[model samples]
Target: MDELVERVDAEDRVLGVVSRRDAVREGWLHRIGVVVCRDGQGRYLVHRRAEHLSRFPGHHELAVGGAVGVGESYEGAAARELSEEMGVRATVCLRFTFLNRSGLSPHWLAVCDALLPEAVAPDPREVAWHGWLTEPELRQALGQKTFTPDSREVFDRYLASRAAPATVRNRCP
Candidate 1:
């Protein structure tokens, strides 16, 4: 498959153009990633980016992720990344919030979270390793700057949303 790509302005507005290589080199692309976690069984998945990566080499990040290729939706990108980076295929549940890092460049990000089975395989070209992280461990890693700024932001938002109270239902007004 062709590499993912996008076109955005300084403010991260989709400008309707997509070029895989140009986006990475010029930093004007939007990307998507999936964060897979398990329940009390203690299974989760994270990927260590290849050392040869042009950006954020050796840093640990959520499961699969990559730029959103032309004519592809954010969810599509997430699913594609999951399969490409981890060699796992499953349905994904996407969230509405877009964890964008505009300060770095014209890049925007669409982050998603999901649950997957234990079976997983990492791609050597894009990922060096894969592992599970506990909530506290994940927090500590973020505090220590072990993750990329974008990853940190996405995780923070995910945690916050999980802690938010659900709206009470009103019956029989």
Candidate 2:
């Protein structure tokens, strides 16, 4: 099915909805929801994109995510994406990260961390392979450009959030 994506303005205000193909081709601003999953061992889950993907094929990503559908909430998208890509149920706690405009696609990226102890079963169509990485390993991988641009942004924001004081992180939006 042709996906219908929520379109936004340069400031990340919702304008309307458009076909995903047009959204990409026209550089339309949209919303991307990401879920960073971690196991009980504190290792982060990372996945390799399928070679047949339209964008960043075979690249590693730090989170399970996708473009927000036309009328879907960011929280809903995050949980849906986590389930679809990783085959895991997640209770998403979304935090608005930042608007990333670099590269071909521009999107308002919202990130959240999901704690799941069970092993992940990645979907073959979306994920080619998966691994668990320690923080040091992820930092090394970031230096090597192994992650997709969006994934890089997400990881950076995640790191920043971690470094933030607990009082600041817990304040209601």
What's the count of clashing pairs in each model shown?
Answer: 0, 0
1-173 per-residue lDDT for model 1 (tens digits): 44646576655567766556666567655655454555345545666789998778988875467667777777788888888877877766565445375334546665565667776777899888777777777777667745665766677666665555543211100
lDDT (CA) per prediction: 0.64, 0.82
Whole-structure CA lDDT of model 2: 0.82
**Residues 13-94 of candidate 2: C-alpha lDDT, one tens digit per residue:** 8898788888888888888888888888888998899999988899988888888898887778989998998888978877
Pairs of colliding residues, candidate 1:
none
Give per-model TM-scores.
0.77, 0.91
Model 2 ranges with Cα > 4 A deviation: 170-173
Best by TM-score: 2
